[model samples]
Target: MSAIRFDDVWKEYGDHIVLERVTMEVEPRAFIALVGPSGCGKTTLLRMLLGEEQPSRGQILVDGKPLLAEPDADRGVVFQRYSVFPHLTVLQNVMLGREFRDAKFSARLFGAARRAAAADEAMKLLAEVGLAGQESKYPSALSGGMQQRLALAQAIMRGPKILLLDEPFGALDPGIRADIHVLMKRLWNETHLTVVMVTHDLSEAFGLATRVIALERSRNRPEERERYGATVSRDLEIFPRRRAELRSSVQPAPAGTTRSGKEHQPGRPGALVLKEQP
Candidate 1:
C-alpha cells in the first residue's frame, strides 16, 4: 500500500497559485526528498501533508486515509528550528509527546510513576540518538546540532511510521550538517521509517533520498492558453535509486569535536567534500 499519495493537488493564495495539478505517491518504507527553489511550493506541499492547509483541489491520503489536522502516532515531523523546550531537560522534552498522547489511561492517569516510566523511555530514545549521557541537559545548554538531534529523538519517540523533515539541518554549519547527515542515515537504516524531506540543498537531497523529486514550473500548450496567458506551469522530475557512491564521501563528522579531541579548523583535512556521482 502507498504510504502517502497526492492526486492532482493544487494550492492557491487568493489570486496567486502556488502549486498546480501535482500528483505523486510515496511508497511505504521509501526515502523521498522534494527539492525546488524557494517559493516553488515545497513548504506549502509539506504543510498540506501536515494538514496545516487544505488543498484547493485534489486529495491527499496517509496510509490510504485522509490526513489529520494534528500529527498522530502514525506521523512524526522535525522542522528546521529546534522545537525543544528551553526550560525542560532533553529527556523530559522527548517524553512529553508520548506521555500525553500514547500511554494507556492508567499510565496517563497516574502522575508520578507514569512520568518515571516515560522518563525511562525517553532515556532509551536519547541513547538511540547518541545523546544518552546528556539527558539532564537543557536545550539551551546543548549545541545547535545536538538540539536538532534531540528534536529528532522526540519526534521518533512515538514510533511513527512516517517521518517528515523540513530542512531540519538547514541552519547548521557545513561540518555539523554533515555529521547530522550521517546520523540521519544511521537512524533511517535502523528504523526503516518512510521519510519525506523538503530540502533546498541539492547535495542533501542527492545524498539521502532513494528518490529525488524536483518541482519546476509547467508551461501550457497553445490550445490550453488562456487570455491572461498560459497559467504558470509546475512540473516534477523523479530520479530513482540514487547512487550511494555520491554519498559515501559526504559522511559528516561529529560537531565541535575532532579525532584528536581538539577544536576543528574550518579548512581541516576531513571537511565536507562534494563529489558528483551518477
Candidate 2:
C-alpha cells in the first residue's frame, strides 16, 4: 500500500499560473479521479506527481519520502495516447515493461533465459488484457481500445506502487469505454494499487473512483483567470469506502523492498517506456 500527499503545491510557467495552493492527502490503495477545465493544470499536477515537472512552491510526497526528480520504479503511468511503441510488436511492447524497470536508463533485449522469463510474464499480462492473439501485431494495426489495453498491460507489467493515468480512456468510443471501464475496475480490484486519474468524464470518474476531486478557478473573468489559478473546488468521497476490503481482495504484488514494512515501494508510467512516440 502507498499514500500520496500534496502540501501547499503551486505551479507556474513564466507569466502563466496554473495551479495554486493545491493540498490533499491520498490514502493507501485509493482510486482518485481529478477533473477540471482544459488549462487548469490537471495534467500538470499529474506530471509533477510523475516527476516530469516539479511543484513551483511546494512538494509531493509518496509514502512519506519526497518524490524524485525523475520517475522511478515505484510509479507507473498510462497516457491517453496509449503510451506504447508503434514500431514494436505487441509482445515486444510488453517485454519492455520488465526491461524498463530493470534497466531504468535504457531498456533493450535480454539474454536467452531472461528473455524467456520476460516473455512468459508478458504473455500472461497480454492474455489478461485480452490481447493474447494479437501478440504479433503492431500498435498501428490495433484499434484505439486495443492499444490502450496494451498500454495498461505494460503499465501493470511493472507492478507500480502508484499508477498515474492521464486521460487514459478519453479517446475510445462509448461502447469501448464501457468495456475498458470494466477492465479498469478488474485491474484495480485485483491489484489494490493506488491509482490517480485525470479525466473530463464525470460519469467515468463517478463510476470507477473511490474519490472524485474537482479543480477550477473561483474567478474566471478574462482578467482574473491568470491571477487566480485553479484549486480544489470540491472533493467527493464515494460512499461505502471499501479500502480495507480491497487490500484483502488480492495479495499485493511485491515490486521491491517495502519501506518500514508497511509502505510498499513497489515500482514508472507503464512509459514502451524509453522511446520517442511516432
Candidate 3:
C-alpha cells in the first residue's frame, strides 16, 4: 500500500528557510490538496516528496521507509508547465515508460516481438488519455490541455503508487481546466492512486481534495523570514471516508465523500484537523 509521512521536516537554502517543522501524514489513496499563497513552500513540499529536494533536519517516509534522494517509479509527478519532450512525438513520449521498465541494456536485448507488445500497450494508453490519433504529433503541436493529458498518460504508463501534481492545472484556461479535472477524477477513481497536489485555487482545492492543507509564512519580523520559514497554518479534513466504505468501496471515494464516515469526527467548519502539529 502507498503511504507518506513528514516528520518535523525542514528545508533551508543557505539559511533561507523554506519549510519549517512540517509534520504530516498522507494515508494510502488520499487525495490531498495543498493551498497557500505563492512562495509559502507548497511546491517545496511536493518537490521534497518527489525526491527532488532533501529535508534539512527531518525525515520523509514512503511506506514507512526513508525517502530516497532521487525520483522513482513509486511516485510520479506532473508539473504546471508541460513536461513532455518537444523533440519526441506523443507516442514516443508515452512509450518511454515501457523502455524504462527494464534496464537500458536489458531493453536492448528484447526481441522485436516484445518491443512491439510494449508499443501496443502504449498505444492503448494513448487512446485511454484521448490522444488516440494524435500519437504521431509532437508535444509542441498539441494544445495545453492535450499536452497535460500526454504528460498524464506518460505518468500512468509507469503505474506509480503516488502521484504528485504541482499547479498542474494552473496555466490552463477555464474550460480546459474543467476538462482536465474531469479526466483526473476519472483516473483517480480507476487507479485509487495516492495524490498530493499543490494549487493556489481554493475552490479547486476544496472541490478536489479529501484533505486541505494550508501553509503560510509566519514571521512577525521582516527579517525573520530569511531565518524562519513557512509553516502549516491550517490543516483541515474536508471529508473522510467511513471504514466500511473504505473496506468495501473500490471506486474513487465519491466526490463529497472523500473523508466521509463515522471514524472521522467532523471539526470546526466541516474540517477535521487530523494532526495539528504543523
Candidate 3 lDDT tens digits, 106-190: 5432778877887798898888778899989999999999999999999988889899999998989999888888788767766
Q: On a 0 to 1 TM-score scale, where does candidate 2 land against the true structure?
A: 0.86
Q: Model 2, 1-278: lDDT tens per residue? A: 57788989999888678999998877667789999889888999999999999899989988678999898768889999949999899999888868875765767655788888889989988998889999999999999999999999988888888999999999999999999999888888778578999999999998998888999988899999777889998887766543433446466544432212233222311100111213
Error of 2 at 39 (Å): 1.5
Weakest ten-residue segment in model 3 by summed lDDT: 269-278
Residue pairs with clashing backbones, model 1: 178-252, 217-233, 218-233, 218-234
Order of all candidates by lDDT, from best down to worst?
2, 3, 1
Largest TM-score belongs to which candidate? 2
Which one is best on lDDT?
2
Q: Answer with 1 or 2, whichever has the higher lDDT.
A: 2
The per-residue C-alpha lDDT of model 3 at residue 234 equals 86
Q: Mind giving the per-residue lDDT tens digits that candidate 1 earns over 100-121?
A: 6755663242578767788877
Please identify model 1 stretches exceeding 4 Å from their true place: 102-113, 219-278
Q: What is the lDDT of residue 43 in candidate 2?
A: 97
Clashes of each: 4, 8, 6
Instruction: Select the stronger candidate by TM-score from 2 and 3.
Output: 2
